[model samples]
Target: MYRFLFAIDKEISYSDLKTLLKKGSGIVVDVRSKDEVDKGRISGSIHIPVENVESDMSLDSAEFKSKFGVAKPSLDSSELIFHCQLGRRGAAATEKARSLGFKNSRNYAGGYKEWSEKEGK
Candidate 1:
C-alpha cells in the first residue's frame, strides 16, 4: 500500500553495484531462474527469481528470511537491487518491485554476464 515518487526504471552501473556490495547497504537479488543461478551468481546475492519476487517479498513469507538470512523488506527499506543473466529481466524485476512498494528498487544494467566477464569469474 505504498506509492513510489521516484522513477521505476532507474538503473545502476556495475561499478555502483560493486560499491554497494562492499558497503552492504543494499539487498542484491538475482532474478534469474534456479537453474541459471546454480551455474553462478554474484557473491552474497539473494536468489529470488523474477517470477516469485512479489510473493517472496511478503513479510509473511519465511522464504525470504530463510534464504537470504535477513528479514523481508518493508515499504521503506533502504534499497533492493535486482539483476539477472542479462539486463532485461533485471529491468522488469525492478519494475515489479516498484509496483509492490519497493520504491528503492533498481536494476543492475550490466548483469551477471558483464560482471563475470569483467571480474573473470
Candidate 2:
C-alpha cells in the first residue's frame, strides 16, 4: 500500500497506480496496441496507442469525445497517466505528452504485466 501525496513528474510505481485508481483521481491512458488492449486492460482506462497519442491529444473537445467517448484532457492536467503492456512505449507516450505541454504526465513503470499479476486482473 502506498499513499501518494505529491504529483509524479515522469514515473509512477504500481502501488501509486493502485492508489490512484482507488481514489479515482487520475486518467489512466492505455497506450497499448488495439490487439493488446482487446485482450485485457485496466478497467476504465482510455486507449490511445503510443503512435497516435500526440494527434489524439490535439483533437478538439467534441471530436475527442466522439472518438474516445470521453472528454479531452486539458494540456495542463496533472492526471494523465500513460501505460502499456510494458514500460517502453508508455515512457515514449509520457515523453510525447510532456512535449505537447502536458507537463505533469507520468508513466506507469511497472506496466500492465505488474498490474494484472498483482491485482489478479
Candidate 3:
C-alpha cells in the first residue's frame, strides 16, 4: 500500500508531447475509454483505460514480473504520462499513478480535448 501527499497537474503542451512521443523514452498511457481512443489518439500511446487500471488500481508491475518469470530489474519508476478527454481525468490518473509508486508519472493537462481543439483534428 502507498500514500500520496503531493498531486501532479503538469500542463504538457501538445508540441512537447509530440517530441516525447518521437523520442520513445517512455510510455504514454491513455486513461480515456476505447471509444475516445478510436476517435483519435497520440499516435502511439498505450491504451490502459483509467477505469481498468487494476484490481486495486495499481500498475501492472508485479504482473509483468511474474509473467516474464525472470529476475527482471525492479522499476524505481515508470516514465509514464497519462491523459484523458480533459484535464480532470488526467489529474486523477496522475494521483493514482503516484500512489502506485510511479515516480516519473505526469498528467497531461492539455489532454485530447485541448489537443484536438488546438490541432483541429
Candidate 4:
C-alpha cells in the first residue's frame, strides 16, 4: 500500500523525499547518465539512465536486482521516485514508468542541482 505522508502526486519535493527516505517508504531512481552521475547523486538511490528506464524496469525481480542492486518495484508501487540533473529527464523517466504500469510513480523535480546545493554535495 502507498504509505507516503504527502500528496501522492506526479512530483515530489526535496523535503518530502527526505521524509520518505527516512521512513524507508520509497525508492529514489536517478535517471541521469554515468557522466552526470559521477558528479553526485542522492545516497541510496538507484541509477537507471533515462534511455534505459523501460528495459530495466521491465526486467524480472531477480534480473532487475542483479542489474540495479535493488528489487524491481512492482508496477503498483507509488514510491518509485525519479530524478535527473535538473528535472527534465526525471520527468521523462517518470512518464515512462507510468506508461509501464507504475501507476503512481513520481519525479523529484528539484533534481541533483537543487539537492546538492542544499546538502552541500
Best by lDDT: 4
Per-residue lDDT of candidate 3, residues 1-121 (tens digit):
8996764335566777777777866567688998999999876676767866543234255764464332222234344678998878887877776666665577888899887887778
Better of 2 and 3 by lDDT: 2
Q: Write one digit per residue (lDDT tens) for candidate 1, span 22-121.
A: 9977788999999999999999888888988777776464866776797777666656789998899999888888888888788998999999998999
| Model 2 CA lDDT for position 76 | 74
What tens digits encode model 4's per-residue C-alpha lDDT throughout 1-121? 7775664599999999989999987889999999988888899999998999999888989999898778888887878999998999999999999999898899999999999998987
Of candidate 3, the 10-residue stretch with the lowest lDDT total is 68-77
Q: What is the lDDT of candidate 1?
A: 0.84
Q: What is the lDDT of residue 29 in candidate 4?
A: 93
Ranking by lDDT: 4, 2, 1, 3
Q: How much lDDT does each candidate structure score?
A: 0.84, 0.89, 0.68, 0.91
Clashes of each: 0, 0, 0, 0
Residue 92, model 1, lDDT = 89
Model 2 lDDT vs. the true structure? Answer: 0.89
The 10 consecutive residues of candidate 1 with the worst lDDT sum are: 55-64
TM-score attained by model 4: 0.91
When 2 and 4 are scored with lDDT, the better candidate is: 4
Q: Tell me each candidate's TM-score.
A: 0.84, 0.88, 0.70, 0.91
